[model samples]
Target: MSATSFAIETRGVTRVFDSRKGFLFREVSRTEALKGVDLAVEQGAIFGLLGPNGAGKTTLTKILSTLLLPTGGRAFVLGHDVVTDAEWLRPRIGLVLGGERGLYNRISGRENLRYFADLYGLPTAERERRIEEILERVDLSSAADRRVEEYSRGMKQKLHLARGILHRPQVLFLDEPTIGLDPKSARETRKLVRSLVADGVTIFLTTHYMFEAEELCPQLAILSKGRIVARDTVARLRQLVGGDRTLEAEAYGFEDSEVSALRRLPGVSKIIEEEYGPRTRLTLRVRTDEIRPDDVRALLPDHPELEVKERRTSLEDVYLDLVEEEAH
Candidate 1:
């Protein structure tokens, strides 16, 4: 697609931060937060950006939202240059970073939306109507009159969403929008995101949750160390694992010797263990073309009962493989 066809575009964009130390805080070194990153987000598409912590997701979002200037290259939102045309661009896009701290604790949710609407220059009558509409859409109408401080984390997150879309922006940037919400709340938020995209709002979402990205975004990019390591549809990304099968087993009272024994299996290439109180979850990677569940079972010393299942490749597997390869 042409550059103008995208709602958000960046070319060789870079951001650098000066690290300082000592009492005077003299500049000691420069760290490259974004290293010539390039991206194109199609209009009305939900594009997911996945990365580990400090991978420059927030930095890129800030530059696109015009909250921070890129040190090199260029970015355009809705065809408006992010740096030079920020005044014209701000009203066309909205940003919702994770956390409830952005809302005013002393004010009602309705009031907070009203304040942002006013900033967007929505007339009195239009502001009231928009506020009501957003509150209903985000399912926060019941809590509109209550002070924000009295609301729960999920409620606060919904309010943040309502505030972001209060002006009906053409593009929206969501940075870990469901970070601290419960499962139900996260599902609700994802539904809202889909509804917004259906209404023609372009969504640029940053998340660490692979399943969430796979469910919401048709296309995604994996960023590692300020650069994109992989970008494609979730299905294509999963193909990076290329025929590798995953064997998952759950058991109680797993000894370290058993884990070591499992690692020695013929086809087992990698083992990841997660402990859930008294139970242990083991995910084993079988590198062969065909998955041999018997191989995994053969290594298990008959002790506590174990439940095992086999599955195809997943986005998490692809992401881990790419990031690990990049590190090497």
Candidate 2:
């Protein structure tokens, strides 16, 4: 696709932070928060950026939202440069960062919308109309008259969504929009995202929930450290494991020797073990064509007792593979 066909584009976008410490806070070190990252988001696609905590996802989002300047490279939103044309771009993009601070506790949700609508320069008549429409869209119409302090976490999150779309921005940046919500609320938020894309709004979503990205984003980019490790459709990325299938086992106990023994099994590529008090979970990647369920069963230690299951390769597997490769 041509550059103009994209709603958001970046070229070698880089950001560096000068870490300072001391009595006077002198510059002590430099950290490269974003290292020459590049992304091209289609005009009406829900593009997901997945990463671990401190993986530079929020930093990149901030840069694209025109809240911070990049140390190097360039970014454009809706065909307008984020740095040179921020005034034009800001009005066309919406930002919904995860938090409750953006709303005023003393004011009613309706009033908060009114205040933001005014900041966007919407006239009184149009502002009221838009506020009502957005409140209904986010399912906050019943609570619109109540003070923000009275709203639940999910309701507050919905309010954030309503505020983001109040001006009907062409591009929306959602930084962990469902971060603190319950499962039901998060699902609803995902549904709302799909509806907005259906209405022709491009979404740039940053999230740590692998399944959420798998369910919502047709395409995703996995960010690690300060760079993008992989970018493609979830299916294509899952193929990164070649023909390996994940083997998961839940057991009562595990020992270091048993783990070492499992690692020595033929066709086993990797193993990750987790313990939760008395229960333990083990995830293994094995060449499906070469290893059978019986093969895995025969190698298990007899005392611990384990239940084994074969699972399909998922986005999280692909993400870990890429990130681990980058680390090495």
Range of the 10 consecutive residues with the lowest summed lDDT in candidate 2: 235-244
Q: Quote model 2's TM-score.
A: 0.87
Separately for all candidates shown, the number of backbone clashes (residues 3 or more apart, or on different chains) is: 0, 0
The alpha-carbon deviation from the true structure for residue 127 of candidate 2, after best TM-score superposition, in angstroms, is 1.5
Tens digit of lDDT per residue, candidate 1, span 22-89?
Answer: 87666588889899988988899999999999999999999999999999999989988899889988
Candidate 2 pairs with clashing backbones: none
Q: What is the lDDT of candidate 2?
A: 0.87
- lDDT tens string, model 2, 1-328? 1235579898999999997788765758999989999999989999999998888999999999999999999888887788988888887899999677788989999999998899998888899889989998889999999999999999999999998999999999999999989999999999999999999999999998999999999988999888988888998786665434888777887778877888887777778787878988878877656766566677775844678888787888888878877787
